[model samples]
Target: MNQSDEVEITLQVCDPKIIAGLNKFIVYTIKGMDKNGQFDIQRRFSDFKTIRSFLLTKWPGCYIPPVPPRKAFGNLEQQFIDERRLMLEDFLKKIATLKYLWYSEEFQVFLKTPGEIEKALLSVPKITNEEIINKYQDAFSDLSGREINREIIQKINDFKAYIQKISPMVQNFKQIAKNIAEAKSSFQASLIHFITVFIPEYENNVLLEYVEQKERLIFANLIQNEDAQGLINQYCDLLKEPKFQELYQEVRKEGKQLKAFLETFAEREKYESQKANAESRQKELQLELQEVLAGKTTIRTLFSKGKKEDHITKLQQQIADVGKEIESYQFICDILTVLVGYVEIDKFKMEKQFQYYNMIKNIISYEINLSKIAEEFWSKVLKSENMQQQQ
Candidate 1:
């Protein structure tokens, strides 16, 4: 079926539970509906793995989301089961969104009647480990002999390595996000405290200090915007010091770097998506090529047997083109990996620099405290003077 099929699918992952009908095996009940029909399928985690392997083999072009790792012994944990259910739901949603796979017979069978799959699995003969190894040894030897499979294997390893490297960095990024959030909260709170609490109390001394420095400087109403502006200017001058200036420049530099990193990251994601599309198209082309060669479609009669070769040739060309596109995306992704690594390093350094330079905020804090003390001192002095005058 094509993209025009009026198809829609929705799935909900239920909490894991054991049931009597299912032989007490802990399984997830997935409730879903589509234009074709609705279904409630009880599936064990192992069932998902089996079907996923089939999908990867038969529909390599589809973007299959990763599933949660299997737990042999700890599968009974409620929290782990919940997380796995969420991930499984996500995977199903991705499969549903792939229009090409929506009408796939295997996928439909999987969603509509899972009991059929169970029966098929039951019919399959089990082999001993020795027999399995002996039977697959030749296949493994043949696979190792093929350059293409070797390259694919290498790419898979590289992908896994990249994920391993980035996993900790991604976790660390959560802390960075939290740190920035707290910093912002602190900044906002400081503004509120300065305006609401510190201003009326400390403004007299902090603002009047300049009056002592500049002789004959007339102070406007003590609590006016004029005093606040003077204090702001004084604070600005302190920040203009060379040490603070350098720190400010560093922050700006880091900000620009972050902008660049974000732009490159967006490009990387775009190309990655494009690669997925191209790979899907490649699979289509390959399938078409197979059909033409096998004379399984109208191309054999319409194009004539002799000209049928031309269709196969054209399909092969399209497949090659998509393959090249996939390669280009892979190269771009590799470069992006390096760039992201650098960005992560830069981010760590930037966080440290920000924490160090944030000490500059203490200047205003110190001014506020000193002004509070001075205001208290003057209040005492005026009270004593008034008492003496009354006497």
Candidate 2:
């Protein structure tokens, strides 16, 4: 093909190892195929084939075939090849950038210098060496920073000295600066390790024993205090005193009398109130009873004459209602009598005990009989009434 017909395709090599090795291979292929000190286009194609084969073997799923001579690759295959080429170019560019950054003069100097520890200390004026030591002490009082061991500290100090010596040589002290950074990091880490691993082992048992002893001492001192002794003595003295004994007896007697008076007063008040209400109710009931007993005042007379059946039904209902009212009044009166008798027995200070007791029993018996009479009266009134015929 003519030079114009030949497409110049740039192959971007990604991995440093791969780039180095492939570049060598390409150079060797170019040399081997050169004829009469001239570039051979066919030999370049052969190099492409060999490289393609190697890449396909390494990454089986990757690698697209070259377009056929008469037909260009389809849009999809062209896009895929474009994307792969872009990715490989990006990878190579990143490697070149990293190499430039790694070998820069500033980075080389940074690796060499003993960073100004004094400047850092001055910037943070509040954090002194004493403060750092105190912090370690507070965290782990038993295992001192010395637990990091003399050899480790000596090595760290030596690294610091070496960094300082090489600090003036800006280009040549990269390794020293790196060593100093690493040593500082190690020292800090060892301090933490000492506190975590060694301090607890040293102090755990001693702290427990010390705490127990302190507690015992505190308790012993408390028991020996004058206030504690005085409290005990006061309690004993109160138990033994004659005045206390007399006062206790008097209080007991007063309490018993007060309780008895309260109970008696409550009973009398209850009975008096009930008796007054019952008497008032009885007067009202007596008036009703008189009205009922007067044969002229029958239920038929109370309601105006209407339809005969309606009138009769109303009369019967009135009779039943009046009978229930009389029974309720009787029940209330009986309850009042029993309560009054109980109060009389309880209130009469001079009454014979047996007489008071007998009065209560009689009152209760009277109440029972009164109840029976009321029930019988009600039953008779209800039974005699021809209620169904009235309705």
- What candidate 1 gets wrong by more than 4 Å, as runs, is 1-4, 19-24, 116-391
TM-score of predicted structure 2: 0.17
Residue 327, candidate 2: how far off, in angstroms?
13
* Per-residue lDDT over 1-391 for candidate 1, one digit per residue giving the tens place of the 0 to 100 score: 4444655677898968865564355688889788777889888887777776555433322233345566677666685677678768866876676544555555666666657465644443443323323433332233232333455445444543654565556555545655664564465456545543575445356745744532222223322445345554444343333232323333333343333334434555665787788889888778878777887876434656556667777778888877877886665444444333433334444654765557456545655754564465334434443234545
Query: Residue 263's C-alpha lDDT in candidate 2?
Result: 43
Residue 280, model 2, lDDT: 62
Per-residue alpha-carbon lDDT of model 2 for 145-258, expressed as tens digits?
Answer: 233345543543453354345444533343444455456446545643443344444444454366454333322333245754444334333323222222222223223323
What TM-score do all the candidates reach, one by one? 0.34, 0.17
Error of 1 at 275 (Å): 22
Please give the CA lDDT of all the candidate structures: 0.54, 0.35
Give every collision pair in model 1: none
C-alpha-based local distance difference test score of model 2: 0.35
